[model samples]
Target: MRTKFFIFIFTGIIFAGGLLLCSNIKTKEIQFEPRQEFSNEIKISKTFKVKPGYKLIVESDIADVSILSHQNDEVDVNFYASGSSKYLKDLKVDFEEGEGTLTIKVKRKREFKFFNFLSEWGIEKAELKILTPQNINAEVKTAGGDAHCEGLKGEISISCAGGDIKLKNHTGSARLSSAGGDIIANDINGELEAKSAGGDIIVRKLSGSIVAKSSGGDVKVELINAMGESEISTAGGDVIISAPSNLNAYVDLNATGGDIEIDFPLKLEKKNHDKLKGWIGDVKTGTKIKASSSGGDIEFRIRKGEI
Candidate 1:
């Protein structure tokens, strides 16, 4: 009996030691160190003269882009490039100009077979800042970086594969999408459509029609002025809407696995715990707002006077 007890104690000690070693390994794997140095850095600046209503197009593989409106009729392009020594040596920016359009593209001199794997470690980054006329139409595309634009009176389209998108204080229509990042738009005056496959979407002070959808994140919108219709949905997140106190619109809210909460008084056309169909004020305007969530709650409220 004593030998059996000794054997059991030894086995227990060995098992505990193995578990402790694994815990240490996991902690080390999650620990991160800040990067304090880069092997290469490059800056390029160019200016292009164009008409007032010219079109600006930009494409990049791994760069964050910022496009803004300026008073001048010329577009100023500035590129700030930095990465490892090998990546910096191969980076290139190409520019082309047509009758009423300007195009800028960033490319690499030689393709690295393992660039996709290395990029996950954040070994390189390039950022572009473009300033154009206030009324120029803009289109921007990036494979792995954020995109931002503001103060343009023409239509704008932006897409990013692995980063956020932001549009602010613009009078033109906008269509934006991201594969794995959030989207935010504020003070927009025209039609807006935004979608995210794996992140949240928030829009405030909107004056036109809006359609926002997300597959794995929340959807929220605050209407400053309702000119048309609005529809927002999410598959795995909450939906929240805020409107003015005296707004006249029909609202329909639904949640599949959660509650529907409305913090304002409504004239009920239909009512239930998980679904609500009502009008904020008179339904004479025929304006409609719909919000739905598949696996989360829905909240519709009246905006405070501060909004």
Candidate 2:
């Protein structure tokens, strides 16, 4: 009993230490950003000298974030706020600039334990927008607001707790997720990993391998010319995948509470009411295509007018 009690005490001490380390124990010099884009919005904007190979990281506590590509070599950070500037006093903007990395963290100051609950009761609404060169890698995170990353030609990752996520025109591997909101991925040319905890996922014009999933909503994927090994699944909603009719692929689809539908002339290997295993073309030279659902239908079809 004594040993177990001591172990539990030690574990709790470590956990509490981690929590304190995450917030309220700060000691660093930082910077805040943006410039006004409209009359009713207060903005502070700044530009940083950066190279093409530098890594960019951003964390927005409760603000929506938009990342876009710029023509110049430097990076631009713009922050906009609505309502009184007095609440700005409770915001912390931290910047860490090194020779190879630039990290920007923006969040409300959590001075004490009750600071967040009290501050968010009537605080200013804000947003963060970033403009950087097209060749830099980036990781963006948001607490509960939407995140959009566009025209990035390098590895990009984004996550949101409870807002929508959009990735457009990216040329490198991308990772995207949302806790309770939808995801839209368009015009991507690389491998992708996208998921949603409780919302739908829609993908279009993808040219590489993909793994897209939804825990409690629908999933739809529309691909471009040349494909790769792909997996699309959902836990509680429908799944629809459309591709070129002549692509080389081995298809496998399953559904628990609904039917599985297909349009391609597949070489049927196995078929039943709740599952299907087949080949779209020569599987030896093709990729694997898999789709599943727990409580909805699964449809594998060719793109409209591609018949």
Candidate No. with top TM-score: 1
Over 4 Å off, model 2? 1-42, 84-86, 111-118, 305-307
Per-model TM-score, in order, reads: 0.84, 0.82
* Tens digit of per-residue lDDT, candidate 1, span 136-180: 888899887899998888889999999999999999789999999
Write model 2 residue lDDT over 1-307, tens digit each, in one string.
9999999999999999998876655654455676443323457788899987789999987778999998999898998777544556667777889888999888877554644655443445778888999998899898857999999998888999989999999998999989999999989899999999999999988899899999999998987864678899999999998888778888889999999888888788899999999888776668898899999999888888321
Provide the lDDT at 202 for model 2. Answer: 92
Q: Would you list the C-alpha lDDT of every candidate in the order shown? A: 0.87, 0.85
For residue 35, give model 1's deviation from the true position in Å. 14
Residue 68 of model 2: what lDDT?
92
RMSD of 1: 6.3
